[model samples]
Target: MGRQEKVTTSLAGTVGEEIGAFLAPVDAALERDYPGDPGTRQPVHTVYVPGDVFGAGTVRSWGDRALAALDEHAPDAAAFAAVLGLDGALAEAVYARVRTKLEREPVEDLRVDFEDGYGSRPDAEEDAAAARAARLIAQAYEDGTAAPYMGIRMKCLEAAVRDRGIRTLDVFLSGLAEAGGLPDGLVLTLPKVTYPEQVTAMVRLLEAFEKARGLAPGRIGFEIQIETSQAVLAADGTATVARLIRAAEGRATGLHYGTFDYSACLGVSAAHQASDHPAADHAKAVMQVAAAGTGVRLSDGSTNVLPVGPTGQVHDAWRLHYGLTRRALARAYYQGWDMHPGHLPTRYAAVFAFYREGFERTAARLARYVHRVGGDVMDEPATAKALSGHLLRGLDCGALDLAEVTGATGLTRAELDGLATPRRGGGAT
Candidate 1:
């Protein structure tokens, strides 16, 4: 069999066995203790926050000032747009108009991403400064004053580092380690990851580090940024992403869409295209398909065009634009990202609305399915198999919660235990 066929065959067998085993119940006590409601478990959405948002000088003060500004304007659409790197005048006008009706809603996770080559590129002085900046940010988290969960993006491995025969990547990661234990979880955003071997190589280095630090072997997790054209066009793109996730195994956390880079790879003009552009949607779909249900989370890229317009019209335009993108992401099951405080309310509003809507629809479907598949114990393997997969998916997406799902579906905790099992079949569900 060819590689694709081989992969397909292997996946089918694996998924089938897993489903069968998972449906079989565990000890009654174990079922009660598991936190997942199966029916009502919603996907967690992580929001990405840019590291460089705090101005270049006097980092703490800059951060404080930015926070203050966000506090004042986050609820206002225009103000939020302005803080998101949009023009100032226009952002203010929008803030004035939308400030009254907004509420405070913040997601749990916030990611701080480093600029390209902060660690990997040449320039001794520049790299040192970058290291210092990273340390400062990590220190902020260590102080326990930042978000509850925080993550950092590391530089991707580059050709120059490879050519020099210097373990530049190692040196950079070492600096981060010295700064502090990994930040909540490290998001090693690998760019241009075209092959599985690249992921394995990074994994080897992480393993070495884990041993040196006496940390558990699989403690560090990663989030791959599928940016390059080559990565998207790879013969086994989904499989490649899966391999990357497996490299981290217990450590793999999530995957992020790189809108600009992926667009560039497609030979599409990057100018004026927002993160929610049609091209971006296509890219996100590919990523979603690749990450369907192995439990690894997925994130959509940022809206590049910060909304900056005078009058409520400008701010409204910006909100509508961002709202569309936010809607798209929530539709695809992504959580959150690095947004200005001003944008927080919108992010919260959009995400909450999406989940509320999804839950309602999914709940109905699962309720119907359970009723259709009544409790009669069956002997036919194929008939049992089809019903099992359908029920499992319904439970996974919060369609069935403990109280409602268990009572209505007649699927005991024992039957739901297998829902978390990784299926080699597809991506994040």
Candidate 2:
């Protein structure tokens, strides 16, 4: 027999060069920011305060105010406890937990708003407001009361407000520089971004500010708020979220959804505008796909419904906010905006409940997979990553304790910690 032809099945290249080339920068950017292993504390929610009202003691005051409001709104703790599924004692304890969390980190992230939060004022008034915000920010830093993530939200890059936005940013940053330096994790929120050029221009301005202040380049990160249809879809009808991130050129760290603004842009009536609306769902889906594995964090928008009632009973609104928070969590958008203090209780309730409810099952699956035991269900590496991520998020968010997680996962605290660092590859497509 003729020499048997040696079987030669050469593998094709690992991936198309064009695809690799396209992904190279995004991969690099992901490594640069690496949202999963945030070096700093990541706030569960951000609280926006008007420019003139923001300052050092503001966080503490806000917490105190929130507690007071909670007391008045939920005069019957038992009733509120029933709603949260906590017994009287446990309910009080959870209430205490909320109070403590608020007092300790009332605002994990703060936005000194110069846009909607700070209504249009005269130019001189705006300037003064910016200066006041700067002083307050500096004072908060000095007092160590500032949230881990803190910054200003300037008006949009629309032609009408472009100059004003730039001026506001420059003034606040300049004032911050004069005072000392920007706070750690400081970032600006550029709202209603509709084009890549807008983000690019903002990045250039941020770079200039960094250079002018003698700070390190790329230190001034900004988050893009996708509120308009144009923001998500390019003129050519392609998804623009990735392009928007690229436009930041390493200065972008997050993409936050703006519910009301987005709904309005889509012509949804105020009555129909909501976080759970299909339009919001579509926008969030685009954001997830665009930012996933790119290191740009995603945040859902706030509900306009405040947890307050004319009779000072906030049970109904509290329930609504809790449901909304749970919906966001279900969608895997862990972060959202908090418009009122009453929203705090429901936020924690939903997040903690999610972690706790899944902990046992997730732990069992992880343990079985790790031990190579038969459990009727096979677990893959992705499963391991997901379990680790869920537990780690719970830990990071103050929802689950290290001890509880360690016991459940059959892993040492250190081992679990290792898993917490976002796995490098094989993420969801």
Candidate 3:
């Protein structure tokens, strides 16, 4: 044959250059605003305690109380499993892991409440509580007893409490600076945000705090609590959540659903207020889409029905809470709220069970995809990233052991992460 063509092309070189030039800004925006997940270890749940009740040993106390609840109600793996309908074979493994998780790390994330939980207080009292919260959290971190993430949820940015909210945040961060240094995991929750401007105001306030404290720019980040209809949909009929995220200017860590507040706002009856309520689902569904590819995480709201009272009553509540948690996990809302210490056991149980149940299948698929081996179901790059991500989340939350995943997949943690992150060339993608 005559000399085979060494190269194949359709468009002229100038056409390609012109096209690239035209799309350069679009690429810049994608890289800047939609950089994807930060590959960080996200906590499984957030525990909100009133500012006055939070102390240096609150985390440990919660763990002890949760363990005590288990001892009192469900004395064994079989008993505990019966309440939640866990598989007979998987019950022991899930129960043991839950106990171990409770003993080792009961609360992964904590938020000292100053809004609804703490309620409106006198300025002096609120300021003192805010300052004390900082001191106690600082000591916890110093003593190596702090949760992985801890922060405060100041009052809303409404016109009435705007100044007070700003003051509390300043006092808190300023106190942290005095007490040594702020922890890297320090976060804030802005509650009852009704408009994107409120989010922008939070960004401005953080910028001011950074300048005042001589901290690096953008050092503070906050979660926007979606509790109002206006926050989900604007008067103009636009999805306001997407705009709210943009207003954060790269400082929104998560969009947390406020179950009760949001439900009540939608005129849902008190008895029907729940995270799984249709109203709540619609709100969070909007949030999920708005946050996708924006590096912003989504947190489902909590159930007000706590696990407490007599054994029978506690069992009912546990079943409800556990079922709700499991359902939320199936929908991909990994993080949630824990309102009571009794809720801790079931929360961990649901999470561990979800991950452990799928561990083998996910590992097999990920391995096959990585090795380019034939399989009954063809896997794609996106699916590979998701499979690897599931394993990583499990590993992060102590649901699955590193060695166990490694054994199943024949891949190390770093290799798994490489597979989870897409690259333009010569990588997982």
CA lDDT of every candidate: 0.50, 0.79, 0.92
The better candidate by TM-score, 1 or 3, is 3
TM-score of 2: 0.86
Q: RMSD to native for every prediction?
A: 11.7, 4.6, 1.7
Query: For this target, which candidate reaches the highest TM-score against the unseen true structure?
Result: 3
Ranking by lDDT: 3, 2, 1
The parts of candidate 1 lying over 4 Å away from their true place are: 1-108, 117-138, 161-180, 183-185, 235-243, 246-250, 339-341, 356-429
TM-score of each: 0.59, 0.86, 0.97
lDDT of 2 at 95: 63
The list of candidate 2 runs beyond 4 A from truth reads: 1-41, 75-78, 84-96, 310-313, 371-376, 410-414, 422-429
Tens digit per residue, CA lDDT, model 1, 42-158: 333444444444222332332343344445445454546553443454444334322321221133444444445233345564355445545754766666444344454555655
* Residue 237, model 1, lDDT: 41
lDDT of 3 by residue, 320-403 (tens): 999999999998899999999999999999999999998888999988988898888898888998899999999999999999
Residue 27, candidate 3: how far off, in angstroms? 0.6
On a 0 to 100 scale, what is the lDDT of residue 31 in model 1?
A: 36
By summed lDDT, the worst window of 10 consecutive residues in model 2 runs over: 33-42
